[model samples]
Target: MSALPRPARTAGRIFAWTVAGLLLLAVVIAVWVGVRGALAYQHLQRIQTGAAQSTAALAADPSSAAPTLARLAADASEAHQLTSDPVWALASHTPWIGPQLAAFGTVAAASDELLRESLLPLATAAQNVSIDGLRPVGGRLDTSVLAGLVTPAQDAATRAADAAVAVQDIDRTPLIGVVGTAVDRADDLFSSVSTAVDTLSRTSRLLPDMLGRNGPRTYLVLVQNNAEWRSLGGIAGAAVVLRADDGRLSLIGALSSGDLPRGFTNPVVALPDEVTKIYDTKPARYFQNLTQIPDFTVDAPIAREMYRLKTGTDVDGVLAIDPVVLSYLLQTTGPVALPSGDALSADNAIPLLLNEVYLRYAKPADQDAFFAGAAGAVFQALADGRGSASGLISALTRAGEEHRLLAWSAHADEQAIIDGTVVAGQLPVTDAHTARFGVFLNDGTGSKMSYYIDPDVSLAWGSCRPGGQSAPRQLTLQLTLTSRAPADAATTLPEYITGGGVYGTAPGAAEVVGNIYLPQGFELVSATATNGAGFAGGVHEGRRVLTFGIDLTPGASTGVTVTVRANTAAGDAQAVVTPTADAARAPVVVATCGAG
Candidate 1:
């Protein structure tokens, strides 16, 4: 309003211009970061595809994959540098978007570390000892080749596992939208790679010594029949004693459940009151029931004693496998000829071994003989190196993932490495990151009726308290069991398959004992059975157990829904159920938790 204020107005105008210039600079920086980030994301998609292809080729041609792995490592390294550039680092200190920026940098760094330090080194080592090098030749595995991979595998596994932990430790709650999702995806990828490498490392360490590098080792191989459910897949009806000496393997003898005495006068090993209360001495007394308890650590010892009492041969370890695994192996070994003139191929192994044998042979003795012969033939083919090495490895990996292959060792150090793995056949483990449940089934029909039972498992978690709060969260597990047997099974099916009511179960009805083991520290709030089925509760290995007995006649169905509360909230909820004759049942997880 006055001429004397002219100097003050000019000063104000200069200050306004300075502020506008700074804002423009900020806009330029934001646009640059966005464009770079989009390019990085596109490149990462290509890296992921290349990584999958390279990994697949590693088993076939390790040397050829090295160049691709190195290129991926370079791309990941570039991404890390781009995300941590000076401008991006400065913007990471901003208030609202700071956490997102930091998370991006963290993920990029982790990817770089995983590819360069873990996978690249692994590719180099794999070239030295390819998957083909581990195959059995002339009925013997060359242990020396496996022994050579132990150190390199351990190194690669340790690096990858450590990287995975770092990625998993990133707190995604503070990040917004796609940043949080990106963190989760990275965590999943690292966890899977770490698990696979760790398994390889463990195998490299265990196989040499367990294959009799030091001395002779004997193992009792239980060929579980999933048609007759036991807690650990099925009953051990057919078995063989395998001897390993200086990397050479030979089957000493074959035996059936009938070949051994039934119901030992006394338990082979002292039983815990919990076990005896639920299972009595049945797991130890009857050879067919040895897997009824669901804990292989305990079952293996009893099996060793049973074999000793029956054949006077002391075994160094115990192994259990279902016909599903045999079928997987057959995919590699081609068809094996059975004594009955029926060729056992990958396509027919499951139904033939689990069902057709029962229908073809009315007598129990004939069925056992056929099963034993099938098992022996498969083993002989594998021992003769009759398949692709890479195919064999893939088959075993698939079986182990499904918990269809199990092992137990008498040696303490080796057993320690095997304990927490899928091969251990232990109860599902729960921790801060995962809430795991076990839904195991054992047949009470005293017949091979489980092959006709189909299972459906669904898991869902309730809304959880935000952040690091220690409030309990709810998880619901719904298991549906459907009987697929024909309506006139009692009259049309073989008496041997139906049990003929010998064990007190109705002729055509299937009786199943379902044992649901809750996660450690989780409480079972409620268990409701459908169709008037009855359930009981117990405790095993410090976990809550819910037992349901469901009796289903031909063309009938039933189910049990359980609600449990976790001590701490977890985003990952999983269930491991009994492996049946059907294709593996993947648990369905929903966001809402309820009986519905």
Candidate 2:
């Protein structure tokens, strides 16, 4: 192999370069194919698991069983090709309700290869949509493109249908905008609220009464869990009667904290009979609901209540959102301006806090002398050494967005409030109560009640404030309802028990029951209970009887009427009537004589 001609040598150099180029190309192609294959495999795994979980969730849902099952069936039919076949014995092995987009994101974050190839695409898409799709409508920043376009209502519904968790706190409000941004800036917020609500609504399974309304009203009952209500015993309870008569939301009797709040109060360690007694005291108020837990995964109590309303009577919608967290967030974060130039960023503290709740942010703390002795764990979990409020803010933002309930949060202040009308509110039991003395005025130690008038009409002003009774230190863990108004109300109902306001007055049975009032002035009513029937068996025989023998004060014409509902249903042609103050003249013992 001596030196060849010049033409041959040039050709040899070209051939060498070609060979090297081909090798490099081969390596690049192989790497790309491997990365793509891995991602496709991971995605497929997630889909399979997600589908199974969706199917199982449908079966778990009592109210939406049919629809959920139907949807699952349809998905199964479609994804049959994507699923494990006889050839792929591991198809059904996809974890039930496999990882969601967030979970996928998390997993992608862990795998560098997956991140670069898979999540990078999603990030790109999200970025483009965030930049180009988002626009301002009428001087407001509108996330409409992300909201309605990248995330369609139908798709939202579908994702919810595929979720493993149930939606509990659907917002009573629409999406809110404030501070020139949306409170809930993340797309995930929608996923949370809508999904939770859909699940709860489907799971609740309420039946419509003649009025087509589920419950009478959202009764804000305050119960204490102090030593008095517990060791002393569950006594009187209070309530703020919101009579949903034709949707007008009539405000009726407002009892003081001394009365019904004791019934709703829960002990730090023990739950008692007060729960039942609260219900029993006002049986006529059938359509009842408890406010949602301030900041936690939706609990068994809420689920029980929803189940009762959905399957039994048309219970009124619950307005339970953590008032303390809201009060704190509203005051601390200040007003959240919306994308629509709405100044909700500051003013609508109440609704803004509530909407955030629907989306599930960590519980907040008040900047002022608020949240004195409350649990700060939830927020701490959110703040988690972010080491700064900004970090806390970032954590909250991410949490809310991930939950898709953030739309209810005052996240960006420029996004339109998801749905924006605040017709009613559930005062998150105001605060978690410990058992208190059944007596209202007396801490059992005897603290007299104080009053701070509204000045204009002498309405409720600082009633829940002052008085040595302001913060009773006896929470029994057992809860009951009470009012901050109606000075004459009981802190805990007489003869009530634990777990509910149930009491034993009957001749044969050993168990007790509880009841709540149906809404007044409403053409229709509905109701439900948690734990057990009739508010943990607070009813005696079958009646949820509220005996308010209105005494006529001097020149007094209007008296508060207490409605009593019998747990037993009347036969055909026989309508059960709840008595008002006008019915006082009638005999209390009107006998229909059980079915003979």
Candidate 3:
């Protein structure tokens, strides 16, 4: 307490001052780290929110999306800088919080690169063009404007794909909790962007020739009637002839099945064995029955030939769409006023076109006229720029994904691009490692009874065999068919819809010809149906096929289950059902095979 030697006092003062200085330095470092980390986090959140909003807007309205995207890019840039700062880098090497900081750094860098390389270019391209202008006027599209988009879209698509790969390349196992969740979300977002960009790239490359950039082209557009169901969704009850020249599209003619000459000889002499045996060669004489063969590639050419016999002109391609696809398009175009003074909106298009038309018009001629008018009105609305282009594209993309829309090109180059796409409407070429199941329905009642029919399918596998590079498995498939019509449908529904004994079945009953195509190397061990029904088993196209007959009364439901012995191991199995007038509620895969 008392003052001692001067040297000792000086030493004590120096020690106290040194301690204070060290404590202040520590506080400064802690404050700097906390502020920087908080700012980085705020920018990261903004990047995520802005990116999502911009992506949604890009699909619905690209011009408006541009600003949001710009903001997102700016946020991402700031995040990248903050995460890459020297302080953060040194902290990232520390324990506990190090992994989180590293993960943030990776995401920030990837997001910044993606925005600059992909989204900005696309947004810029979007700003220059009007979505409405994408539609053709007087059957002519402004190809020059569309041409300008191809390069930018392609570049963005390539960059997006690369960015997705880069994001996937980052290792996120070290990060945990919120940081891990954020990284996962970023990965998922980029993955979706990659897929969407790939589709855009393909579209840009193909649109020019498809729009008749080189010369005039004619296409046959089949309006499939899902009410009178066929293998490929529905029968070709109505069709339109579309002529495209120099990026302009025009409706040349419309024809219904009744318009074609009856008992005319089929110009197609040879048919696939499956067609000859299952449907008979007379499918050519009946335009509506041409798609009875399950494969669209086989059915499209036959319908085209029949059209040639009827119209004496060849078509360059064929496009098939069901009532469901029309409904999807209506969602984009809003409501269209039909010639009959009836309006068709997205909510009502399917029911009006598929069911009400049959109920309203007993005469085939009147029904045909209504269909032609409705199709024309919708097409005219789209061509006249009445629909949003982005909306239309989204609708079409959704329909194509569900197989409700399909296309076949006569040109080898064009068809090549379509070969593996969902719109190609082909069965899986090979199913060696993966199992495939199909539930295809053809209306055996020869009536509009299909309108009341709802089908669901499920596939379940038991177990894999032991000790092999590729193991065999046991599979079970269950198909459920329900008739949603009123119990008094026989009396309430029109005679045409009830079949009227046209196909030699009971009046007002739903008769369905069910086909199940199994994966390659699969053997039908047994097949059974509810209520004592039977099935015929055979092999077609290197795949096991099962054919069965089912009859359903109003308000009745039945289930058909098939058991199979498969020599091929199952990986990712898929079920392909016939696209219906309504979206299907069937599960794509029921169960996975486990190691025995």
TM-score of each: 0.93, 0.24, 0.76
Query: Per-model C-alpha lDDT, please?
Result: 0.83, 0.25, 0.77
Q: Quote model 2's TM-score.
A: 0.24
Give me the runs in candidate 1 sitting further than 4 Å from their true place. Answer: 1-22, 174-177, 464-472, 584-596
What local lDDT score does residue 162 receive in model 2, on the 0 to 100 scale? 37
Which candidate gets the maximum TM-score versus the true structure?
1
lDDT of candidate 3 over 1-596, digit per residue (tens): 75779898998899999999978865775577678778878987877777756776765667898888888888878878887887777767878778677767877887787787788878888787665566667657766656667888889878877877666555444566777667667766886776676666677677778878899899998998989888778888888888888887888899998988765575364876764665667666688886777777877888788788777898999998877888888887889999899998889888999999988999988998888778877887777766677788888888887877888988889888777777888875434435678778899998998988888787776663321135567778888899987888878888878988777877778999988887666777778888778777556677777888889988888999888775653433567888777764532343543222
**Candidate 3 Cα outliers beyond 4 Å, as residue runs:** 1-53, 63-121, 124-127, 155-192, 263-269, 274-279, 282-285, 428-436, 459-476, 520-526, 563-572, 583-596
- C-alpha-based local distance difference test score of model 2: 0.25
Better of 2 and 3 by lDDT: 3
- lDDT tens digits, residue span 1-596, model 2: 64899899999999999999988875764455345434544553443344334323322332333343344333333333222223222221234212122222222222222222222222333332332211222222222323322323234334443332211111102212220011111112323333443332221222112112443443332221111111111211222323443222333333333322223333222223443453322211211222111111122134224334333422343222223223333343444433333344224433332232222323221211111111122222222221333232333333222221211211122112222211111111111111101111111111111110000100111112211122211111111222222332233321221112223122111121112222121111222222222222232222232222111111222212121222121111111111111111110111111111
lDDT by residue for model 1 (118-182), tens: 88888888777667767788888887866666787798888888888887766555766777666
**Residue pairs in clash, model 1:** none
